[model samples]
Target: MLERDSPTPLYEQVEALIKKNILNKTWPKGKKIPTEAELMKKFGVSRGTLKRAISNLQKNGYLVQRQGLGTFVQADIEIPLERGLYSFAEYFQAHHIDYSNKILSAKIPKKTSKVIADKLGITINDKYLCLRRLREVEGENIMLIENNINISSAPHIETADFSKESLFSIIERYSKETVEYSETKYSAVGANSEVSSYFSIKKGAPILYQEQLVHLSNNSIIEFARVWIKSNHFTLKTILHRK
Candidate 1:
């Protein structure tokens, strides 16, 4: 039952309900959804309301409407990142999937580059922690992750061994600050020579590049990351909110 008197719009409530069905396998891949008239009658909403809901699901990669056969659930990816942040180690452990992190470098750099300085809101010569690692599954590396952390926000953070501990965990535990949220942008980028060497792939391989800035409870930015993920191993799904 949707909350009719709530501030949330009726169509958005309908969209959430339909998306839940798709996620829980209630509506399997390539399975056609109910007709618009049937959905309208069932939800007690107008055609306009229902169409907006379906249109959003289609745009977000959960549904596809063929020209002739109506709408069906899309063929999805192995992993989906909706709106939350996932520490790869914890996720793999929860699912009982064998995975390991090989730490490439984790230390406080003497001087940060201009790009890193701007991201962390620090001066170019100021100290900041940098971490680079490879995420391996089944003997193949699929992700290269690099993190630039605000040293002022997480003082003495370099003392912790990232290979044996979670970065966010250490930050929250030691600094007594909460990681509130993150802003992320996703794009397709071709791998250059440095990245190609890490993945053992040729230069110009298609890869998913994600840039993210994490904020603390006080709304100060604390971490910035550049993640290169093999397209074959992951999929990213984000919701659309017009307001």
Candidate 2:
């Protein structure tokens, strides 16, 4: 029952209740939630209030609405972006999310491009290991990652089992250098044929692209990565604090 005299808005109260039910597994993933009519009657709220509550939940990634159907619990994964210098593998392991990686290719290219060379703070002729990998959770391919690491900083990285290892961990272990911070840029892009094939989505599907340059505590760049993520299957979250 809603408190009619409370200062809190009725829509907010209803949203909180629905979100609680989701987190508690009372409403499981992919299952359709109660219809609008049912929910309005149960909460003794007007149609507009009930819709506002549901809309908020959908915007926050807690619910998904299908045309001609009803709203269902969203089953996508949420990745945090404010973890400082942590890797995706580390984050998933810490959160106990079941994940796996497939190493598509790993090699030291004979030629280096000017853009990648500059990002690694190396000359255009410097050799580096390029690793391409696909990350999956619950049998869905959610991310495609391409990492370029300076060979001098991470020796033998070309032979490492990236499918079972975190690139950041390996770099720290081999170079004895800690990652101080990273500069990242995020943008939305349309998937090409290759990316579309990897995610099994239609061509020109929306993708979230992230490019990052990782630096050591000494201020030396060690790694550059380009990541393509399935937009609908993942959400990037960040927490900001005021100084």
Which lDDT values do the candidates have, in the order given? 0.80, 0.86
Model 1 TM: 0.64
Per-residue accuracy of model 2 over 126-211 as CA lDDT, tens digit each: 89989999998654677899999988886776777788877888888876888888899889999999999998778998899999
| Model 1 CA lDDT for position 183 | 84
TM-score to native of every candidate shown:
0.64, 0.70
lDDT tens digits, residues 13-61, model 1? Answer: 9999998998898988768989999899888999999999998886555
Please give the distance, in angstroms, between residue 162's alpha carbon in candidate 1 and its true position after superposition: 0.8
Residue 158 of candidate 1: its Cα lDDT? 81
The TM-score leader among the candidates is: 2
